[model samples]
Target: MSDWGVDRGVRVLKGVRHFRHRIRRKMDIMFDAYLNSEGDFPMCDSPVWIFGRSYSVNYDLDELRRSVASCMWVTYRKNFGSVGETSLTSDKGWGCMIRTGQMFMAKALILRHLGIDWHWEPDSRDPSYLKIVSLFADLNSAPFSLHQIAQTGSTLGKPVGTWLGPNTVCQAFKKLLSSGATGLDLTMHIAMDSTLVQSEVKRLCLSHPSINPFASATIPSSSIINTPRIDPKWRPLLLIVPLRLGLSDLNEAYVPGIKAVFEIPQSIGIIGGRPNHALYFIGYAENEVLYLDPHTVQPTVHVGSKLDESEKAADETYHSQKPGRMSFLAMDPSIALCFYCKSEADFDSLCRKLTDRFSVIPLPLFEICERRPQDWTTSDPIFMSSPRSNSSGGRNSPGGFTSIGLPGSSSSNSKTRMGSSSSSTFSGDVDDEEFEILG
Candidate 1:
């Protein structure tokens, strides 16, 4: 047969198939739309159309949260244990204190949205691996195997199996960018002590020429937010709050840095809850806040002494990242850390949607929703006090947590306030004087 004859025959077959399929597709679409319109049809909040046909399916919020930031999920078990703090994975393990992972996760989300690659895959042939290991050891005073580093996230400057607080992460971020090794020219400002960071960076550069991390880093004189110190604006500024902050500070500092998905409020990892849990807000409803809890129970047990086997299980669990919702009253975040664009033009655009109010930030209900008896440890009351309340208050009664003192309550009767029963010693972002070693 001629080429044209064969082509026609094939086309005829395709046309008949297309006609049948198109009719079927149309029927499916009409049926789906009809079902979706009915209240009885079970479907996700958002409609998902497949091949021009709407399908009713219920999807969880984790899908939305991950989609928001392209978030990287690293379980606390893998990251914390690779660093001497292995027992932190325990339910009541007070030793688990790595708020930096929460901060890192938040930054990874921001960079993912900004179209910047923030994380690096472990490669055995890379020379930078040695430096990362050495720096991590120097910071933590613990030894780590290259295999451990490759399995979990980079340990860089984190002590093996120990506390990796937010300050260390902020400082390490500076060093990574400064070394001109990572190729990330990000700027970080220590709002609490810009001078301390400046001096520390300068000393490190001068003291160690070969291993001098952060040699090319810039030290700012003032805060990246609410300060007129930095001019000719810099893009992508990551702010670290190592001290206690109020709702007003969180609103003013974060709103300006937020963009649609990349710069959203959750990019600012908030360390809250008892035992200093680190979490990032995904979204909020009328009285609920959606968040991803980095701290979860270990998925597997370490069989004998095989750390690698346990870590592998942890890695698998992390891939299944999940989002959770809590009463706005229960999410009592103590610190807020975020990444921002500091350039004048970009900063304005970032802050365009920002308002003086924290409506965008999923803030917990700090006001006392209900007064509980001093022994009523059923709920945490420390979160109930207003964030605007004065820090200095009467000491907490026995079996009670510290109270910022209830509103309209006198100091003499402050003993009547109730709070969470967990120990107040948090291992996250806090001053040296404020931190207590918990095992």
Candidate 2:
């Protein structure tokens, strides 16, 4: 907290109060109506993504089919085994259920293009979509272990063979991450990792810190894996895609030669076990849909103040990593995003960079309604023809099972984690009388 006091002229005057102006007018109107320009509504078959001129949109196209950035382009297919292309889970295919089926059909077409209707109970084989159920934390804290059950609510107990509320394995993993296709009993894996800082194990944790104490021996350098447990026999499948990055790129240089850029719209590790440090706006990954394969490598490390003309071996593999510029979120619990460091006396105010329209980051449906979630999924829809729409209605009387699904392979078993659904009636988290439903 001391360095942010002067270095670089009041650091842009205390970075204009955590980037005000209603957070840069909500990331300049959602980055200029879905990746800059074109937001009066009406563009169905939703899915747009063009780079070279910059792009980033997802299903909402209709009425005259406006330009949707020209149309289609998300990538990650490596699977076309039919049934929407493979999934026995040796860590999935067709690029993890068509990129989480265009990220839960673009979060239910941005909650029905912001109009928000359908009074719950949808899934009579996809009525357009709506599964909202959340629990988190178990299997010994498996990837966000339900964010420690929302930071420890109810003090957390039920550890053995868990499964309490409406569970059909979390309603068959929110009905298979909302894309369609299910089959799993137990057998899942995938790998491809990254998160450097070795150089002979940081000179042996700075020459033995009380003989390698812990934080995995001196706060992790970063890592993640399982792109098909490939051949350790198996034991790797972990998904937590919530995304957040920007702790000066993964620590190791606070000032001199400054440099940072960990993008990873999902691909910084392709899927192994040490390369997932790219984060951008808040991140999460314990389950809600995670199918895999998103790499775009090509940076030895240059970043900021002119690192060979702002680096981009091709837009840093779909650039991503933004959580208010990091403070703690990566020790590679099968990583969703990293370089936050938690706190150790605020490593130079958590490695600076929280702005240039990082504008305090937030929004993404208010960061998944402050993650008090019982439902989730979003991101990666540069374009492929607005391919994410499903909203049915029927079980208003059942009230069961929640979310988890992602069985492409690993020996294939048929997804698990337990479920029963029906919880987020929208009463807890962030309070003020709840009722968010967003637009």
User: Which candidate leads in lDDT?
Assistant: 1
In terms of lDDT, the poorest run of 10 residues in model 2 is: 430-439
TM-score per candidate: 0.40, 0.21
Alpha carbon deviation, residue 169, candidate 1 (Å): 4.5
Among these predicted structures, which one has the highest TM-score?
1
User: What is candidate 2's lDDT per residue for 1-439, written digit by digit as tens?
Assistant: 5675557667786688667964775455344323311212222232221111112223322311222211111223222222212222121221222222223222222222221222221111122221111011011122212222212211121121222111111222333322212111111111001112122222322242222122242322221110221222221111222221121121222111111112222111111111222111122111011112222222222222222434322223222221111111112111222221111222122223322212333311001111222322111111112212212311111111122211342231111201113232211111111011110
Candidate 1 residue-wise lDDT, 1-439, digit = tens: 9999999999999999999996785565445433432212222354422111222336533334334234433333433333234333222232223433333533432342333333233222222222222322211222122123321222332344444344344444444444344323344543331111223222322342222232343522110111221332233455443333222112223221222222243244443432245555544432334455556554332222123655334223433333454443343223334434434344344233333233445431121112333442222212223321323331221112232332354431111112223333222121221222212
Q: Which pairs in model 1 have colliding backbones?
A: 44-57, 83-160, 83-161, 84-160, 84-161, 85-161, 136-157, 140-159, 234-343, 237-340
- C-alpha lDDT values of all predictions: 0.34, 0.21
Q: Mark the regions of model 1 whose C-alpha exceeds 4 Å error after superposition.
A: 1-69, 78-106, 109-172, 175-181, 193-235, 241-276, 297-317, 342-344, 355-439
288 Cα displacement, candidate 1 (Å):
2.3
